[model samples]
Target: MNGANHSSGNIIRLLQSASANAALYESGHLQVVRLGNQLFEELSALLEACGELSLIVVENELIIDGRPQEYSLFINRFTALLKARGVEYLKFQKGITRQEVASLVEFLSGAAGEPGEIASTGHLRFGYLTVAAGGPPSDSKGGERCAAEVLKELSLKELDRFTEIYRAVQRRQKLKVSGIADVVSGFVDLFRQEGAPLLILAALRDSDEYTFTHSANVCILNLAQAMALGIEGQQLKDIGVAAMLHDIGKLFVPEEIINKNGKLTDEEFDLIRQHPVRGARYLMDIPGVPRMAAICAYEHHAKFNLAGYPKLPPSWRLNLCSHLTMVSDFFDATRTRRSYREPLELDQITTMMLDMSGTELHPVLTRNFFQMLSDLKTPS
Candidate 1:
């Protein structure tokens, strides 16, 4: 195996062992002490190999070595165990002492004792152990005021209006074209000011607000991508509207299923999978809504490899808007914290998307999107 993969595997194992050690210690198992020692030794070896090891927990993702560690069911549980305690990032450098490791395990044991409890420290230090607080880092330019304050407020307000429109549609009210148009115009203006970074930075903000926030983030990402691809004029508006309303069908879904903190049963998943068709049907009723919006709603989940949902009939194909929206959808979804998992680091998010480029997403579009993201994210 390659060094990177080997390191990735060791990190996963170390995390699993650490979590187990915490569980053992908490139950007053005497063997926990021995296990804890072993865990520290293993950690030391890993540090030797890698120079430093950091585990950063974002909303639903566990990041190691600036990469997204592939999820294992057990690993997700362990990640949740850490996230629940508000343990954001753990940094281990060479010569990290066993005593420091013991302290961390003890701390994890205490934290594991109380599920879903938040730790208060922004940065906690225990000898050689540094547990920096979690959540997205402060905006580089904004400092005390977030970089996207104005943009975020504007997007959220637009999202609120868009969300209400969806609700009105659900209630069978008259379609409001003016409000939706205003939202698209507002997004156009926002994009004009800073291009992709304006929306990208805003999207990177914490996703605790959910549905509405997710729609806005995806819309921004989609719009930015669309603009980059020379998709302009009415076409851009159509794509933006499509991106914003891509998940509107979720409103028809049960809150219990959509927001359930645990794994979904097969039946629950099937029900959840119907959103695209449901959303598309609703969009079809809007007097002036773009057909591409409805098309994107229907086929955003249809994979490039034809492995995705809302099974297509023979010889059927996906729309360009759907391909664009699909990439944006998955990118923003994984980038944001959801009810069930943490958000991935930027590198991790890109790597996963690149890996999916050929099969799950449009190869050219995915590659272009990553290039755009890289340019936007680079320090100016």
Candidate 2:
């Protein structure tokens, strides 16, 4: 109905047409060539418009971009074809060509022996969905699970791990950077498999889980932001780790003061403000910890304009990772309900973030963050 849905449906139609033609005729036949050309043109236009086109198979459904399409003969056959080839996900980039489309259709039609037999090109990529099976029992017939369930289970496990890590920190134990890296790596894989940012973020349900839950949410948001900026590999994981530990200094602050519902005395507030420096120092002492983690922990509250706590020299520039964590921190903090205040609506939070852009937040990054949110919300 809408432009996004229309484009998605059109692409699927062209793909089905091309694959059907390829199955009936040779790859170089006139009809197969025409269908491949049409499909390539459609995919190229879609990629140019959206930057990337991701087709993910979640159980029995086909997810184009982030939205699952209605079940149809075309979708059913295509899903079966991909499942037969052990290909659960396909991403098309801007430089995809007609020849690549032909090859893809040929592979889908069983002309190619296996997925690996046809090496993925630069502009076309293939991946298999690795859905976690440990989640609660599925309600759907046949017991098939969905992406949201997988994310929730993984998020809860990560939260439990972070809770233990925080308690260890409170007991003055050495921080295990390897454990943090493992959690970040899991999140990166989850983000890659799951296309929707909103769906990847863990919901904050219980106030008691605030400390670790906030950390998890911030880590997810930071990963989404980093990936949107084309950051990948170890750099992406480092940013995620930085976000996870950004508030580690709060562990040193007394719980009574940290969770107090009433206004804090000036001394209490001052102690609260010292968390950044304290967290940074603690991280600095840990071997194998990413340096960016310490920097982010220290500068997350240091406003973009250098107007917020633990004052640094005006000439010093903030680390980009810290800037990212700061934005995520503010977003998750304002959105989650706390003892002192009720959670704000999404509209209010976005408006406030916009108002603080260029002052409390990096202007371009702030806008980019919102744009990412907008894209996720758009029907695809």
Candidate 3:
């Protein structure tokens, strides 16, 4: 498996390929990985410090195991370099010859060139940060994002590792138990470091992609409701953990069921209903997952009207955190797309949620909840 293997049972019927056929192996070397003025230099220094890399591909992410400490510093340097050249990288990418690239690199490095006038080409080339593409532009695709720009923005924010971790989690056959805990830890740390509520809101609402972002958003909203109800400290963190994973059940649901194109049959609905129970079970295995976290997962779907699942013990009561989690969970879910149903616009989602407050979500938390995220979208 150390080599590229091509097979076509084309039943050569008459012809066969010879392993010894030098004629068959043209272009034997791997393609050169082009670098901008920045990444090229970083890669050079890193290669000089570390020997050959042990290439390991787990889906779309990369890990260079030999140089552990150097990796972080190299990534940081690469990120800064990319950010400095962000928009420029996306602006001029076509008919760019090798000499042109070299000239551009020299200009970026501030060497001895009177800056030549760049003709507006109306097309930009891309670097390959996009996992879908191999980090570089293939043939020019109109209006496609430049991979370098995306990497540059992420580098500025110091979020490359987060993106890497998230993609890695998504690629695994299943999310690892340890991985989920690690991510949830990162979420809590962000909350702790945040001094302003606006920062927390922006961190959730802006920049983050759909799935993980939505999950973290709901958890933050749920945590706010906890504070309004006077929950504090470790108790608050416990509830945050539960809210973060309210949908762990969906991870186990078939992609078809989760992405269903339209209304589901009663049988399909039944399968969907099993997620709350499933999610609670998965969270139960994690070490130190408080009873509050597990219980919220178990009962977040159970209604205040007593119309939801795992019918409460004769006296099994829902509490502040559980009720709040239910509200935030649905709020983000409605704003998101589904297989059978397209997602509602934000205003439409809010209006519908407003209508269901007292009966479904807790009335007071629902009221404070709207206000909690009200200052959210306004520019700081």
Candidate 4:
């Protein structure tokens, strides 16, 4: 017996306690596993002599049967491998509180995105609680992105709609400000009414191309903001067009700039900075790309404090969409990695956004946006 087995309590108790919230926990295997009070501790090599078998350590005890010794060796070898990579040893131990287990789903979402396999077969078989069923961290995210793409491909209607919306805003440079109420309303309808299906979107979060996937993420953010403000109907339709095409400007920037391997000079930086206005001008010709989107292109970079680029008139205040887009844009950009920097973790980003609320974001809207994001992250 290991010191943990001899000590006061072990992992089994912790796991069993959390099992009350059966939706969050599952007993992965069986074979007379008994645990201690502290589940997180490591107790191995005991199995090496016992031979091989399927085994799992819940919060307190060691459950083992069938080829127990080989199973022990497998675990020991696995521990060594993970340790070399800065990973801690073995099954999330007993020390991990019930709260931590619940948080695993959200933490995994950041890792898996939408196409992740958060749930084991056991979880699926035993009715688990899903945050936003089929949303990211579930099986359907990829499908959702595909559906959105399919809709984009088949809906010539939006193309014509965006064309008119695009031209209307170009005469002046205010960000497709016309018919936007309608654009946002439609954006609301897609998810709220169309039941646009969240599982598909969840699947993409798990795909290989995470940064590109941020595009759909941003669209969702923008859409949510539009709906919360009650901008519906034709106005919603226009917003959806604007939201979907907001990044169309990036098509013009060099891939090197987008995926640069390293830091850039002031000149390179200036060129990079031009994306918003550049995005605006590029869409100037796209008949279907909404001018509101074009405007978003120009003004999305324009900060609420009036410090961002394309320095507009002194009296100009950012529109609601532009202001909302600012947070979404930065959130997506910072959370994804570049060759030079690792992605900023979500908790860190959440903390940073708190400062920009009044200065860069629409205050109330920012609160709701953060709330939605936070709620989504809380384990189901």
Q: For each candidate, give its TM-score against the true structure.
A: 0.58, 0.61, 0.50, 0.48
Give a tens-digit lDDT track for model 3, residues 1-380: 11111111110100111111212333232221223323334333333443212211111212122111122343343334334433112222223343443333433333123333333232323232212213222333211222222223323233434345445534543334344445555545544544223234443444445556666667766665554443444555767777766776766677687777778889988888888888788667756666666777788899766578866664555755677788888877776555456767767867877888777776655766666555444222
As for lDDT, the candidate ahead, 2 or 3, is 2
Clashes of each: 5, 0, 10, 83
Candidate 4 residue-pair clash tally: 83
Task: Output the number of the lDDT-best candidate.
Answer: 2
Q: Model 3 clash pairs?
A: 93-124, 93-125, 127-135, 128-135, 128-136, 259-339, 260-339, 260-340, 261-340, 262-340
Best by TM-score: 2
Estimate candidate 4's RMSD in Å: 20.9
Candidate 4 lDDT over 1-380, as tens digits, reads: 34434231222233333332332434432211222212222222322332211222211122222001222443454323222222221223223343344443232323212332233232111111112333334234544554556455324454355555544444433445344444444445557544433322343344344433565556666666554443434344555555555665555556678777777878877877877777778667755555567777778877878887878887774555576678777776676655678878777887888888777765655666665554343211
Q: Runs in model 1 with CA error above 4 Å?
A: 1-146, 152-159, 170-175, 198-200, 378-380
- The superposed Cα distance between candidate 1 and the true structure at residue 254, in angstroms, equals 0.8
Instruction: List where candidate 4 sits over 4 angstroms from the true fold.
Output: 1-190, 193-201, 209-212, 378-380
Q: lDDT per residue, candidate 2, 145-168, as tens digits?
A: 233454465655666777788899
- Could you give me the TM-score of model 2 versus the true structure? 0.61
The stretch of ten residues in a row with the least summed lDDT in candidate 3 is 5-14
Model 3 spans with C-alpha error above 4 angstroms: 1-185, 192-209, 337-346, 378-380
**Each prediction's Cα lDDT score?**
0.67, 0.76, 0.49, 0.48
Residue-level error in angstroms, candidate 1, position 50:
59
